[model samples]
Target: MARGISLNRRTFLISTSGAAAGVAATGLAGTGAHAQDGALPEYAAWKDPDALIVHTDRTLETRREAIGAPPITPARELFVRNNLPTPPLSATDDPDVWEIAFEGVASPATMTLGELKRYGVTSTPAVLQCSGNGRAFFDHEASGTQWSVGAAGNVVWTGVPLARVVEAMGGAAAEARFLTGTGGEDLPPGIDPLTILVERSVPIEALDDALLAYEMNGEPLPIAHGGPVRLVVPGYFGVNNVKYVRRIALTPAESEAKIQRTSYRIRPVGVEGDPSQPSMWTMTVKSWITAPLHEPSSGAVVIQGVAMGGASALSSVEVSTDGGETWQAAELTGPDMGRFAWRPFALVTTLEPGRYTVASRATNADGDEQPRDFDPNERGYGHNGWDAHAVELTVS
Candidate 1:
């Protein structure tokens, strides 16, 4: 069985020559200190105490303590997802020297991090959500992380446009249909190199809106997330945003990488055959109740949470205090961060002592509302069914 490799602060070492050189110069190995001496503290020490380790020490999920966090998720409160062992911070100590190799263009090129910055920088607020955010709620368990509602975050990313880099590489051929990105993460021992790679591809058209971000939420990107340089695809699932990005390739065909062809794709339940389904791209509309973790004692109770509209702006959010039998409009809070960012919503109501099922549903400007029941897919890639997010609460 394929497994995710786990690495802790103590067990993780700078194994690559490029990283070793950076570590030798700065002594950052295992120190948890980011590139510029003490700009950011170590990952283990800075994250919220309520953060849950979803996968070996590498992946973390936000808990109630971080549910109502600001529009821009703090570095410490941001959730984490890794396809491979976390790259050592030393690998990104000097953004100036980092190089990204490009191929399959009219003029294959290699651009230095410094040169890449010459295109100028832009910032945009967006949500990065794992495709499997609600997999845990599936009646049939998914094979990977069983995330609930905490496997997502909204943040403002700062970086150069990916289109700029593509332009610098002499543009793409008309036949190039996909833009593939490769990360610096290492594969576990004994894993067949041919079987998989930490790489994924997006439609070439997406390059115009994508960003190669070096700064997230006003701080230098941290290794825990994708630091030094990570690809940010606004309005797309987190898997499309590659971390520790080191290569960009214009391809005539989509990536044959395992992550692209086999994993991350949504297929009918019990589907069989290779290349069985389409890959997941844009996220589905979804909402979650963050505050009042449990049923509040009788009388008046206030409930709050977040809603995301995927590719469209959120039109409204409705809360149901009694299962899906009835739902009332909830007050949407926070500034309009943009079409791709999550919006905060709240609802207050007086409840009588009893058992209740509390749930929320988000509707996008395009008139797509959350569904009461989303049929299960084989891999559980996108489980946005409203019933999956309902919580059971009992008031004394």
Candidate 2:
């Protein structure tokens, strides 16, 4: 279980009031931490007005109304998840000057953003999704932010291949079993540092597809989105793609970083501190409806959604207007972004004035299909089960 913070309602109200006053006096928005310019990044306020702020003002989840955005999520509208408060690194406008330390190899080295760019750049379209994207839908509430279905985005990442960087650093040692990444975000005051660091690790095998991305969707990565450089692990959950990445180390064993070994692990109900339970890695097959933002008027309506096959390619997505009793194939729309990006699907139908239940399910090329229900787990690390994503809507 996570530790809790205690604060009297009076004290909290007073503190917030004072903060708002400070912001007003400074002519700055009260939405996010101030950057070096003494202002918040433009992207910081790009979210929908109804977006859920799961953690104070640090993490923002997009609302369902904005889920079916463009093929590539707009930089300003992309979801934001910060393990810690976003540092004031926005003061540094020149991404070329940012540096990353590489250690634990035959030749420990460091690479600046400028130097990293010399390796040549490559672009790949992929999806970045929170490991707990659908945690809010769980029958039992889970720790952390209770997110519904909008904690994901599809973007084209432009960067240098991590494998090349590893090779440039003299390659990995024979004993190296994991590649750990550490971010530059700072923890809140009064919090213990040793027990909580925004660090995570992936198996050495993932290096082949990992990247040190500097651009997203053709734009320079914004400060709110880990500008300059961030790790992009294709096919892995968003947590594995550390933002504000500062260091990369080759280790003989998986990182013992709290987030790597404990927080992201999947433990069964009533299980606590069990090392036997494995940590989350690749996401599971999942799909969700995005259209019919609300109750629709009777007539012709279009239902659209997105599906991801996780490590595999998506084979098909089906939609059912009569609950899960029967389903019809949804037309797979949009150009194929890539094997790692979400695929869009749509279904059009006529409806009468009445209430209806709609659901969506996706199947992967590997023959894996979304389940109708999933067993409850602690922390809600991975909610992707056989359960179909269903919504109740009224037509008038």
The lDDT leader among the candidates is 1
Which pairs in model 1 have colliding backbones? none
How close is every model to the real structure, measured as TM-score?
0.85, 0.85
Ten-residue region with minimum lDDT total, candidate 2: 1-10
Supply candidate 2's per-residue lDDT for 324.
Answer: 74
Could you tell me the TM-score of candidate 1?
Answer: 0.85
- Give the residue spans of candidate 2 off by over 4 A: 1-43, 46-55, 89-92, 187-192, 385-388
> What lDDT would each prediction earn against the true structure?
0.73, 0.72
Per-residue C-alpha lDDT of model 1 across residues 1-396, encoded as one tens digit per residue: 001011101111111123223234223332233322323234445676444333335545565335683566776777777777677768768877878888878788888778899988999899999888776666565566556666888999999998877776678977899888888787777977546577888888788889999999988887888878988888889988999888988898877778888888888777752555778888878887776654479988888888989878888999988777799999988788888899898898988999776778999999999987677787767777676566656776
**For every model in order, what is the number of clashing pairs?**
0, 6
Output the TM-score of candidate 2.
0.85
lDDT (Cα, 0-100) at 390 in candidate 1: 66
What's the residue-level lDDT of 180 in candidate 1?
Answer: 86
